[model samples]
Target: MAERNNNEFEGKQKNIQILYEKFVILNRDLLNFGVSIEELKEICFKRRKTVHTVQGSQKNAQHSSFIVAVTVVCAVLISILLKIIFDSIIKNTLGTRCLLPNNYFIWEATRPETNCSMCEDVNSVLVFGNVTRDEFSNYAYSSRPMLVKGAALHWPAMKTFTYHFLKEIYQNVEGAYESIEEECQILTFKTEFRSLEDVFAMPESRVLLEEGEKPWYVGWSNCHPDVLAIMREHYTIPHFLPEDAEHAHMDYIFIGYQQGAVMHIDYISRLMWQAQLRGHKTWKLVPPPDCDHICSGISFRVDPGDIVLVDTRQWYHDTHIDAGEMSLTVSSEYG
Candidate 1:
């Protein structure tokens, strides 16, 4: 009975030892799985932070580019404004100092305030046939505006000066002439230099007379010798002008339509003569600044056949043309 009891105790001790070994193996496997889970969580957190940093850098770059573009645009506009203001100041200062003539005030004092009507008797303008050198000199010295009757009526130019004719001359003649590309305004005048061919080819619609728009005037003053030769065949120097003035060539060819020249003083030369060829023009003249208080403005009409002589330096003049057609004048300067 004692031996049987001892065998039972041994069997029970072996079973307890097997159970402890199995429990230790299971606890070691569970600890390794917990360490793997912690490593996976750390990798996921680092990836999220990297993505947030990249997105924040892209937004900052976009904001900086916008600021740079706005600054460049503002700088360009400021440069243009400064250039315009500087050019205007320089032009005005030079014109006042250099352009006013010497005897400008003396001539302005003697000008007669003749009523603007055409004279019925013989006292208005000297007829072209009766004009003498002495008479022309008297008017020139006094700085009076005169109308010479039948001055250019006999000239071949009066018959042949048409729009198409002038356009053909400008195109066929190959010479460098100053042509103005400008919008004529009463208050603000601006001109850009262009070639004669360019001016001829420009569309007429650019200068089409609109209701409140001023007429555009483009002219060529210093022409080529070839052009002068062609003009000389059609017209001759006035017989009444001084013998020394006979050498003077045609000075200007003013081309415009209605509302011809704006009211402004000519500061370049003393005396000028314009022969009306194609259309009628009306002139409005005011005395120089020194004589404005003593005399009032005068107005007169000049037809196609008449010649007008005036001291341009001493008067402020404006011109208007009859609508529906173009007005052309061939003019020259003489002393």
Candidate 2:
């Protein structure tokens, strides 16, 4: 009986020893898991008799959760601030442009007030035989729709810019045509081609205006550096523009048969000058929809080498190629 009693006491001592060892390991683990040393001690030593009590441990865990939430919220706020700063820097550094699509910017810009008085006395377009820089600045800079005769006659593009010539250059220029598919804008004015890829992939015989070929007209912006470089070599800014006038970095190219564009206002930034390189295009300029009563609309024909200037942003206009060869025009904006 005495030996049995001694064994029972020894077993109890061993069980308590194992429990104390486990508590020591748990304290070490809690410290590693971000629990404060004080809190760990309170959990372990203050309740040495009640090892299952997790009150201090729970408090530490709650504090840790709060700190994690605050850190996450601070990170989100910091990310938003950085994005705003980056956008402002990009806008200021890159010519104050929003770096968005042209259409997006146009939609954001407020439409200019159309002064019907400007178009009041306009019976016909102001045709300039030889417009000096001063005359152009004063008369046709922004208020009047004018045409400068023979403005682009010296350009090599007058005779050389044909369907095949343009198509070939766009194909040869590295990623020139592909850029349109990716980022550049293309207008399939009255055509079935949904993308530049579809336009370029069309059969050459149909593109050549053969018998009964589907007549198509398409317009696209030449934004690729290499493509613009080659095109600039063929043409240049009109000589009559104001000395300090600034032009857009890119130029618009319109090519194909008749049905140029329906009467509509251009959603561009500033006044535009379009050079008729091939065929004859007639311009019908109308006042804004709101000024139809006070303003007078007029029609004029733009011949090859003639440069037509208009504040297309304010005027509703249309164009239809006169019966002639395929029409091609290159245009850019200035202010």
Candidate 3:
């Protein structure tokens, strides 16, 4: 199955390249109209249009205006097409349909800015029972990852974040359902629960891991401010994070009995910090394609109370929790 997914992903990638070439060919006139290749790639890849001034006769200027209008329309069309194809690639690669977080994008797929030098000689993650802010900051912006043991020792979440406790956290907040219904991202992974509402509405027997119940794993961003506030009341930020690092307004909650997220790169804006409040899990990290020849892939375990910080945007990662215990985690990004 993994091999098949890899082949499919490769095929999709080829298809994207083909489309990109065709787009360039069809819009070859754009270059004459003043569109640089870099700007064209940006338009097709990120849907960000760049303004270019045309120099020539009045008739040429009129033609340039027409071309610009056409380019704008074509950009929107290609963006929608790319979104559909990229989302399909994600579903296939993950073997599950999961929504990318609001801040996540396909931009990382077209271009990865990781410095291979950072991946050099990093055979495994560095570990510490505890670390100070400046000490941790050294690895903050790079591809190097660090594991801090007992980092969540003081977080109330370690004890209080059960299925019921989490359900109540969202339940007590006004308009939580509305927020989920419209905007928040949910990663149901391999589970049948399509939405946060479905997750919460699940029967007790399934949620509690009763005999004969199917295994499941799921996660979602705590987008509602009130819900996030109540959740933050249960845990404080990691003291080891740099004081200058800006915290994201929202955080994510992941919990379930077994299975985990698939291997993928994050296109997030900052470094990620995850506290394993319960159970044990292992992360499989791989370097970006450009660094594959020079860098080595590694795996590491995250036991309960251990906090793992990584610039996930720079690493392709997949994770799976050990079978017996329920896994619970709270993660946030810092810029």
Cα error of candidate 2 at position 2, Å: 87
Q: Which runs of model 1 end up more than 4 angstroms from their true locations?
A: 1-130, 134-137, 177-195, 203-216, 246-250
Q: Write the per-residue lDDT of candidate 2 for residues 29-125, one digit (tens) a residue.
A: 5566666666544443343221233366887556566444534543454455455555544444343222333333454355666677767777888
lDDT of 3 by residue, 284-311 (tens): 9998888998999989999988999887
Model 2, CA-based lDDT: 0.74
lDDT of 1: 0.58
Q: Which lDDT value does model 3 have at 281?
A: 91
TM-score of each: 0.55, 0.66, 0.69
Top of the candidates by TM-score = 3
What are the root-mean-square deviations of the candidates from the true structure over C-alphas? Answer: 31.9, 18.9, 12.5
Error of 2 at 295 (Å): 0.8
Better of 2 and 3 by lDDT: 3
Instruction: Please report, as a residue range, the 10-residue window in candidate 2 with the lowest summed lDDT.
Output: 95-104
lDDT, candidate 2, at 16? 55
Better of 1 and 2 by lDDT: 2
- Each candidate structure's count of clashing pairs: 0, 0, 0
